[model samples]
Structure formats: structure tokens, C-alpha cells
Target: MPPFSQSTPISNGFSPNHHHQSTNIITIDVGGQLFQTTKQTLTLAGSNTLFSNLFNSSHHNSIPFLDRDPELFSILLSLLRTGNLPSRSKSFDLQDIIFEAKFYGVSHLLVQSQSNPSQFEPLNLEKSMLLPLSGRNPPSKITTTPNGSLFVSHGSKITSFDWSLQRKSTALTSFTGVDSLLALSSNVVAAGATDFSGLQILDLDLGVVRETLNWDNVTKSSSTVQGIGSSHEFLFSSFESGRRNSNSIVVYDLESFKIVTEVARNEIFGADLGSAIPSTKLNWVPSLSLLMASGSHSGASGVSGNVKFLDLRSGNVVWEIEETTDCFADITVSDTLSAVFKIGVNSGEVSYIDLKNFGSYKSWNYLGDARKANNVKKEGLGCKIECHGNQVFVGKQGELGLWSEVLMGGSKIGKDRIFRKNVLGRAKDLGGNRITNMGFGGNKMFVTRKDQQCVEVWQSSARRF
Candidate 1:
């Protein structure tokens, strides 16, 4: 069936053959080969695009000529009509299609067809492909844009892969290593390290630093970034004084990179464990209008940490939790789930706190065995946990676990709230190097393993690479 076809009936005794040549029927000549399509289908290409301009032009009767390949144009026409590529498009390289899409000013349409985030399937993810970095150093951090472009920091360099995952570019920075990285745009990224002086806004295409942001601490010394995060309008960086006595989380204007305000500023007084622990992880909860900052410290006694949800406007901690029992190895907040999740360092179990009744429930609702909270072996030493879509992904050793909520057909939280967990991938995909980090963009999950130089891409088998 055609996407759009308007048949005008013969009127005033006009013949059907004469009506067949109506202005609604569009004909195009690409490389001297003619193709026909309806004006309604071409209008879907959106305004300012080549197709829209061609149709909106004054020459309706004359066939438009385009100095392009007819084969690729046919595929693009199919896309405009059906909002998907034909099966035969597999024969052509993805790069060629991307180039043609750019020429037609319809690259966004191609991206929508291939890498939409709504297409992410947590259950069907498989170890599909590998993105190899060009150095001996393993990736310290990986970040992704909403459209699926990836940025990986290995040693002092950052490598970026386009949304299609076909082309990549590398840029070097002055830092010895990048401990935290956040992608601000397709070409700009905020990179920082614990040992580095300031957070650098880098341009990946030009391989240059656009601007450097630093915190004004009481110590009057340089500030090093512990973590970087962003909300819709603001960029947040957790910075600790080089003297290691003071720390603060600075909020900046995303557009201008100017310091808007500071929150969670702490100056360590003698033996105050809470003040000594600077937030190493920052997550913005858009739904609740809060920023969660968490950090942990290890000493001879045990590991202790704190998680604080701050109202940025007032610079006040709206909700706070102190961890003295089983400190979290890693933590992530799921806005869709309205919960904050963590994996305990000693228990090796997942836990959560309901954001709806946050202050009332001071204790974490352990999803697994609560008895193991006092384990001596440190079972969750280097585990990583992150939340994407409505699911939580946990990386323990070399294995990956997926946790999904079992809808009980109720909106309120009950005592028997259940979340089922399943190990991701087959047996062959398990038991490799220890998983270091994980990131998600578009329909793909990017995983980096300890001592591994390449980033593994886990994606749905149904989506074409």
C-alpha cells in the first residue's frame, strides 16, 4: 500500500488519462533516471529540506532534476513514505546513506529511524559489537549523548563515535587522565580528573579546550573535579580543594558556562567524616526536581558514606541518608521508577529507597538477602550500578544483571513491592574481565571492562548495527 495517494475523479467530462497528470503527482529526475511520488509523501520530509524545497518550488509541471544517484534517492524516498528503510538498504554501507541524508538535509530523519532511544530493549540486549580505542590505557569513563553518540576517555585522550557508530574522532587533552566525563553536545564535552586542576570544556572536533571552570574554595588553592553532571538547564561539577580540606558542588549555566551558584560546600573540621567525604557521584532527578549527591569513604573501622538530595534553588538538603552499615559500592537514580538504587559493598545486594516517601523510610529496602549486610569478604568491592529507562543494570565482577519492576497494577507502594532480577546475556557473554563502567544511549548499552582496551556494545539483536 502507498503511504499517500490522492485520486481525483474525472469532472466536467474530463478523461481519466488527463487527470492522471495532476500536479499532486511529483516526478523527479536523478542522474537522468525518473522516479514518481505523491506530493503528500514528500511533504513529510519537513520544511527547509531539499525535498520540501523541491515540492514547494514554482515548477510543478516540469520534472525536477537532482545530480545525485537514483538508487540512494529511491531508498530515501522510501524512508519519507514509510518512515523506515527498505530491507534492500542492507546492501549499501551505512556511511553512504548518512552522507546522502546530510546532502538532503534530512540526517535527523535517518537518525530517528535508526537510533531512537525509545527503541532500547533491556531484555533483548546482546553483546553485539566492540568500539576499540587507540591506546593501551583502558577507558576511565564513558559518556553518551541522547542521540547515541559516545565519548570515551582513555588516558589523556577522548575518542568520540558518531550516532551511526561508523565514524570516530580522537582528541588529546592536557590532563594525565580523565576521571569523570560528561557529554554536553555532539562536539563539546566536560572532562575532569581528580588530580587535574580544573574542569575543561573540550571541543572534540577541533581538539581544543573551549573553557576551564574552577571552584573558589576557602583554601585559596586549585580545585579538582570529582564528578560532572547536567540537568536540562544547568551543568553541575563536584570539586574538591587541592588541599583536600574543602569541597563544593558548583552549578553553572549550560549555555554560558558561568557559575550560577554553589551547593553542598563543606569545609572539613577535625574528625568530621561526613564533611570529609566529597560527593563523587551526582545525579539529577528531573521528575522530583532534586539533585542527588553521594560519596563514600573507607577507613580502618569500615566504609561510611552519605547521600543527600539538594534543592538547588535554596541550597538546602531536602533529604539525607547516612550509610554506616553497608556502604554502597555504586548508586544510580531512576526518574521513571521514582527511586534511588544502590549495590552494597559488603552485602553485594541491591537496595532502594522510595522517593515518594523518602524521609519516612530512613532504612534502605534491601532487594536481596539482608543478612549479608555484615559480610567480611566485601563481595561488592568494584561493582557498578546504573539506571536506564525503567530498569536498573548491575555489574558484578564480569557478570551483568538486569532488574525490572513487576507491575502489580497499583500506583501506591506496598509492603510486597517486588523487583525481579535476571542475569544479562548467555553463558558465553559472562565471566570475562571485571566490568568497570556502563553507559546507555539510544538503543545501545556501552560496557567497559577492567584491563580491556575496547568498549563492548550491547544492543538489541533486532536493531541493525
Candidate 2:
């Protein structure tokens, strides 16, 4: 709230005859201050909200009164009208606005206004803040919610931060170290560890284990979770037996938590490298209705990997790509670009395959330094690659690189599509600890570095305030 020269109330230009001029006009008294807006504007707050309830009961004879901060109400009213916060809102604290919005039952409106996915700009992102964690263990895995809330697992504990990044809580888990963490809801998370048995569904708020999901393998040993992912209707978990002889991707109903079916069940025989590998990454491609399961294994021969596109309905591999030379260090699928991207373990260069025309391209299309394809130094050994919106983010060592598709009108896509790269962050933020994990939520990118014991938040500068 800004200081005023006089104690005048903030109001729209509505006079005594304003209601007569427009029947849609409605007046609201907030903390003794008068505010006027249209019924249609209040309806944007959604049904059952305070504003919506007021719209239903509003009468021209009696003005609706709300016992709340006038300044905050004015800001929210501006948000309701403009689908964004006004420049003047920069003067107020974001937490105050969030609390006030919740009171008015318009918290979702505020989230949409502030963290809408359309506002994510790869070029505009910069290191905004650092969220510190307890203990010496760095973040092993991290997950995020659509509303921008995040859950990070370090050692045996998981810390959660709300969408605003203002309030946070910590939860202790049963795992020795959480290797995989997925946010099922704002207050619930599915946590798994490679060395621990079963995927634990935890309640972050109460710090309790809600349930444990496991794969009943024939070996009769405990099933260890390798990766966890979710689509709209189902949750997928890659589980390997304690004996490391068998692995499978188990699918469960997202709502009921019941076993739906299993896919990619592989039994390892003596020295069978292909059947021995287990999926360490699971990504759902909603556009094509396929689940991308990728994993790599290092043997005496060299680093070898496989990327399989699995059809959940039929439990069959729709497409499979064998990675023999210069295998992927990290891989991700971008639904927006309709492509599968990977960072080579040997070359350390970004390569992508067009999913739309899968048969047109026989090999990976290198995005940077194709000459380094034969490099034997394993330049991309510990890198992490992820996609959010249309931009692809690659974390190599301590540096962040952004890959964006350059749109060309009336141009072919598979062979002629152009992609450009840009280095993210400033000179000071370029190098420090090696990046270990990266995830996206809302409009922000969450990055955790090796031995950092903190999560770095990268967001657009335009939305900083």
C-alpha cells in the first residue's frame, strides 16, 4: 500500500448516477472504503467465492460490505479487472496479498494472475532467490506443483514451499535418502528411494506416511523405486527388485491408488545388458499419449542406453530407440515442440529427434558442436536436461544453457527447424556447484546443485515484484 497525501479512498470514477447509467455497476465497502466494479468482473473470481457470493446477493439499495484491508482489496479488485496486478501493487508485500486473496476466496485468481504458464520466458529468467535447506546432504530429488509449490528431498527429510515461496514446512520420511520425489497435491507427495523399499505416499503438512505403493515381484524381494511420474489419470513408477534381477514400470490409478497394470517388465539373464537396464526416467507425452521411459547402463564395453515410447493402453512399445554410441547423459520430452531431446554423455552436446516424423530422421540432430560427437572424455556425464513450456533447459556441471525453437513462417519442421541456444544467468551465477536436479512449476525453474544444500529459483524478471 502506498502512502497518500490525503486520506482519500481509492475508487473507480463512479458518481451517484453511475448505477443509473449502468445496471451492471455494483458497490462494495471494504474497510470503510468504497469500490465499484461490474458483476461480470466479480464472476471471474469463480463460483462459491466471496466475490461471487456477493455478486449473487448484491442489491443497488444496499452496498455489500467486506471487513478486510481496503488497500489489499483495491489491489485484488485491480487483479480481477485486469487479470494482473497493477504496478502500484509492487509497494505491497506479496504475502499480504496472498492472505487477503485467500480470505476473499480468490487465491486461485491470484495464482493464475502471477504464475500463469504463458508468462514463462526463457530469455527473461534469472537467478532470483535461494531457498536454503537443513543438513549437509544436497537435494537428491525435487518435484513441483502446477501452482508453483515445490517439494525437495535431502537426505531423509523433505521440505515444502508454498507457491508464493514465503511459507515453508519440513517433513521427515522413512527413506534413508529420497532419490525420487513427486508432488501429488499441494500437501501430499510420492517419495521413493533406490535403496529403500516401496514408494511412500507422504502427507507433508502432518509429516506422516499416508500409504506405501509397491510392486509384487516374483523374486519375492522388496521392490525399489527407480523413477516416478504421473499423467492425468494414472501414476507410473519404475520398480526394481532388491536382488536387481528384474524391473518393471507399474501403472496405478491416480485417484484410487489401485494397480491398473504393468508395462516394460524385463527379466535379466546372465550378462544380458539390454534386459538388465532399468528405467531411471519416466516422462508422459500427452500429445501422443505415450510414456517415454529412458535409462542408461555403464559396462565394460561403454555407456549404452535406450529410449522407449510405451503405449499404456496396450502395454506395448510403440517406438524404441537404441543408444549405442555417445548415449544420452540425460533425456526429456517436450510436448510443445513434439520432440525428444537428449544431452550426450560423451559429446556433452544437445541432440533432438522429431516425434512427429519419427521415421524421417534416422539419427540424432545435434544442436551444438557436432564435431564433439566423437569426444571420449564424457563431457556430459552428470548433466540434467528438462523441458518446461516450449523451452528446453540443460544443466551441465555448474552452468545452465537454454534451448529455444526459432519459428520460421512456412518452413519445414523435421529437417529445417531451427533451434538457438543462450547461456542463462549472469557472470556471478554461471559456475559454482555442479547442478544435480532441475524441475519446473508455475513460471519458475527450480535448480539444485551438487553439495549446495540449497535450491536456486530462476524466474522471469518481469514478474519479480
Candidate 3:
């Protein structure tokens, strides 16, 4: 929708011999602009890629990318034709080009878009990222894979990436309302829909999906499946019972694909509907074998929420901690645990919670330090945080704030935050983009952006590594 015009396609300028062109030549219309190229180039990225499949199928020659930009696709075609990335029309964005390259399955183009120094000047910030990991429809859920890939859930799909920051695979769900996502294995993903009836298991590579959770058997009409978490062999879903038996947490055995236990119920959600119900975003920490849930939601009186530690074996509350904050945006568990959430509903403030370990609930008093952002009203959004070494990386919808000084240099947290005074609150703001979500794996970081339709991946520079 931004003002951009298509450049004369590079393919139109190329000339080929009659006999050679007759058999392998292909033509396609992109955004009303026509392009012609050889089938060789189209099938070069032959394995499971869009082009390969497109050309190899019955609908090869007349493929339509009507919604996609012709100039960006031209840049992509040029990138594949010549290893050197072609110049853009200046009206388009570098991020947009990067996304087009990914969709067309040009792997090297992603590296070029991130590594090219010329493109880096426009949106300058402190360098911890390479380019971006991916571009999707606002990926709000991110999880690290067993092999260190980043799995992100946004729109109607889940996109996966390896540590190299290359997008390995993508999975889609039939349910339009996606609530939560969990990476169950290298190739399979588990997703739950908004109303608890649309739970699914998706196979990433072949794009096969099986609805693993039966709504009719366990769920009533009012039940809502808020979030999903997983242990090695088990899956846990937070169920909000609207009118049925007390609100509960349900567990499913992954091996048998059957309902194993009703983990915990009334104890956690004692109040019936109309009364305040405690919300805990479900996240399972594999190392500790504990399902971690925490959140703060607004109430009639004030903000109310809790950080609950639940036992997987017996469905008991191992520990619980309360907080006075807004709802949690997301939670991730690694060597260290980090949870990104907002302050109060209309405060336009966000916080990052850090936990050393999932030990005794009483001893786990660690909390996220808050940061205030500027240029936003009461209805505006807050930052999304990702855990890095000792510090949490902050990104709002508009820009990235790499404020290492905010929570840096402290080996352990104190009662009050140990601010890196000289550098505190000073952040390198990377402008002109809306960052929906970001994740780190090995030295690579994946950033999802709104302007682009692909995930941008950043490989760490020597300074950050």
C-alpha cells in the first residue's frame, strides 16, 4: 500500500536462443507485471521450495503472485539469476526485499540483506542482530527448538528456524483463532486455538496436521483454552471453565495421544465466573520438569495475577507467587528464565522477569525490571522482551531498544535493580519498523517485522559473541 512502482523486470531484457527458450522458458505475472525466465532458474531451488513446486506442477508457467510486489519479486528474480543482488527503485524497503528473497527460496539473499553494509545505514542501532530472522503476520509466540531453532506462532501458522537463522520449515493451522504454540519435536508442533476446541498437531516438513485434542470429549461450550505448554512426553493446556466444573489445567500424554490427567483445578481457579480468575500463561521448563505460568490481569479493585509453579507428576501446586501488573505477553525457559509482560493495562509500560532457577517458589522472588517508553498514549502498546546474557533485549512494535545498560553487568539480581548507571536508559533505537517478536538461538537472533513478510535473522558480530 506504500507508494512503490515496479521497475522494468531484468528478465524482459535478457535474450535467449529460439530452440533453448522454447522448451524451458516460463512466464508469470507478478502484481500485473509480466516476467519471463528459464525453467532451469525456476527449478534451481528444486527441493520443496515454492518455485520448484510451482514449476514442477501443472500450474507452472502462469503462476500469479498478485498480492506480492513486482519490483521486489524482480529483485528476487535478479538475485537468483545473478548472485549479486540487483539495485532497488529506492521507493521500496530493504526489509521488503529480504522477505521476498526468503519466499522465493533464495537462501543467500537473506545473508546479503543482513550483511550488506549499504543497507544497514537506514535503520541504525547497536549491532547484536544480523538482519532479521523472519517476517510473518505478527509472530507473538516464540520457542527454541531442540536443535536450537526458533519456532514462532503468528497469524494462522508456526514458522521454524535453525540456529543459522535460516527458516527451516513452516506449519499452518486450520483454526483462525490461534491461542498458543509448543514445539513438541524437531518436525512436529502443537497448537491450541482460542476457544479450546481447535487443538492440533502439525508436521512441519510435509505440512500434515492431525487434530490431537478432542473438544467434544473434554470441553464444554464455554471452556476456553488459554495457553499450551509441554514437558518431554506430556502436553499441558490451561482451561478456563466458563460455567462447568471449576477452572482447570489439563494434561495429555503425547505418546498415547490420550487425556492423562486433570492436573489441577479449583485450587488455582477457586472463584466461579463473574469473580476474578487468576491467569497464568502456560510454559513448561524441560530442564526442571515444571510447568510455569504467570500473569497479572486488571480487576475491579486493581491489578491481580500470579506466578504459579505446578507439578507435572501429581498435578499439585508446588509454589505460587503473586504480582500486581498487566497481562503477560510471553514466557521462555532456558539456562535462565525470562518473561515479557506489560505493566498496568493503560500504563504503556513493560517489564522483563528473570528467574535463576525453578527451585522453591518462596525463594524465587526474582522480578522483571520495568522500563518506561516515550511517544505513546494510554491505548498504545509496550515492549516485547527477549533474554540475552544477563540482559533482556527490548523491542516495541515500532523499534528495537538495545539498552544493554538497563540491566547489564549484574551477575545476580539485588532487591532493587542494579542499574548500569552511566549507560542506564540509554538505548540505540532502530527506527522505521514494527517488531512483533524476537528470539535468540546460539549466536543467531530472529526478528519478526510488520513491514516485511519474512523473518529477519541476525548472526552475532564478534563484539556481542
Best by lDDT: 1
True lDDT of residue 101, candidate 3: 65
For TM-score, the strongest prediction is 1
lDDT of each: 0.89, 0.88, 0.54
Once fitted onto the true fold, the runs of candidate 3 whose alpha carbons sit more than 4 angstroms away are 1-154, 158-172, 215-219, 222-224, 241-246, 254-256, 267-280, 285-289, 296-303, 325-382, 401-413, 416-429, 450-452, 462-465
Q: On residues 287-353, what C-alpha lDDT tens digit does candidate 2 reach at each position?
A: 8988999999998878998999999889999889999888999999999888999999999999999
Candidate 2 vs candidate 3: the lDDT winner is 2
So what's the TM-score on candidate 3?
0.55
Candidate 3 displacement at residue 396 in angstroms: 3.5
Point out where model 2 deviates above 4 Å.
1-23, 359-361
The CA root-mean-square deviation of candidate 3, after full C-alpha superposition on the true structure, stands at 12.8
Cα displacement (Å) at residue 352, model 3? 7.1
Could you estimate the TM-score for every candidate? 0.94, 0.93, 0.55
Say which prediction, candidate 1 or candidate 2, comes out ahead on TM-score: 1
**Model 1 RMSD vs true structure:** 2.9
Candidate 1, backbone clash total: 0
Clashes of each: 0, 0, 14
For residues 1-465, what per-residue lDDT tens digits would candidate 3 score against the true structure?
223322223344456655455556666667877676767777655577777765765254345444677777776666667655554534566556656767877755445433443332211223444433244466656666533567777677677765344345666667564667777776777776655464678777778776556433233555556677777678777766554444567788877668888765653345443223534467676555677765555556554566677786787778666654343333334334343223333343444434543343332222332332222243224446554544445565555544332445555443344323111111542454766666555444566666455555544333121
